[model samples]
Target: MTPRWTATGLSQDLPKGVVMAGHWQGHDLAVWRSATGRLQAWNDRCPHRGMRLSHGFVRGETLACIYHGWVYGAEGGCKHIPAHPALTPPATITVTAFACVEQDGVIWVAPADMAGSPPAVSGVQPLRSVSLTCDLAAVLAVEPALLGQDILRGTVQIDGQGHDVCLLVQNNPAGLTLHALCGVRANKVAASHWVENLRRRAEMKVAA
Candidate 1:
């Protein structure tokens, strides 16, 4: 089952004034950060002509659909329509918005009505994200020490020492994406190589 909050990506990956595609419980999301660093996640579809809002551009605090230049504000309400500059967009012309927040260097999204805060993941810093061709089961088969469905916690060997690692699992249509983090004092370079090796082993297992 999906949790109340789903880890989308790392905060550092989606910097200010940039938009990226994300997924949460099978919902495609257009996650973006404003010029001032405010985070937001909305339905990836544009209300105008079904164009993907993820293909849109971020201007200041608003997102503009690349298809027809339809501008949506922070509240997901249509602020301007290039075709009708003199007319105000109706409040009904709004994109679906989700509850989005940044915690522990990770970006999380859930239904707007979701309650409580995201799961706490302390003592680790953002590492790297890796997309594997295999599923979660293959990952566990390769490293059974890793546990949890949503957030996988385990100790991985890096540079001849055990280092705690956290893998925020995201089940994407193609496969799975692991938004990883490692202990603050761990060798990040070695940890990253370890992640790559794990991906290789898991994927090879699936192929076998």
Candidate 2:
């Protein structure tokens, strides 16, 4: 449902000291982790010149624009301007920031009162993520929910016994990206192969 963790990004993808453009429940998003390993998400536009902040860089705990070198903090507050180093950027120069948190190795973005906290995926290990050109209905049609279709769904073992799955499906501008996870004790080899098969099956589902 509507939660604070709004389909942010694949955990392993966004590395330290880098800024990436992403989407959160259809909203254009910019996600970046500081040198200290803190993650932040905000509207992709820069306040000064409307530069795409994803085109910016993480220079420590702040994100700096490549065009004119305006820097912002995790709270989306403008912290510096290279051209005029003497000026303390006004509070008005800050970018719109959303509440973000990472859990089960997945990134999430939403408003402050972002409904409930991120769903727990205790003891489950995320496998990999895949995007489907079709909607969730199409995805379910082929792989019908083995348990249920509710949010924070518990999936069946992709490779069977002792192997349970955790799925995070969200809609995007184009389609859907399924952030998949498996039980911590699931067979890695079988899990890997199963994900491969899932791709094939999901692809066929979307195509038809």
Query: What are the models' TM-scores?
Result: 0.97, 0.85
Over 8-104, each residue of candidate 2 has an lDDT whose tens digit, in order, gives 5668888888888877766777889999888998899989998899998899999988789999987899988888999998988889888888877
| Overall lDDT per candidate, in order of appearance | 0.94, 0.76
Error of 1 at 181 (Å): 0.5
Model 1 lDDT tens row, 1-208: 6458989999989989999999998889999999999999999999999899999999999999999999999999999999999999999999999999999999999999999999999989999999998999999999987999889998878999989999999888889899999999899999999999999999999999
Deviation (Å) of 167 in candidate 1 = 0.2
All candidates: CA RMSD (Å): 1.0, 2.6
The 10-residue segment of model 2 with minimum total lDDT is: 145-154
Q: TM-score for model 2?
A: 0.85
lDDT of 1: 0.94
Worst 10 residues of 1 by lDDT: 1-10
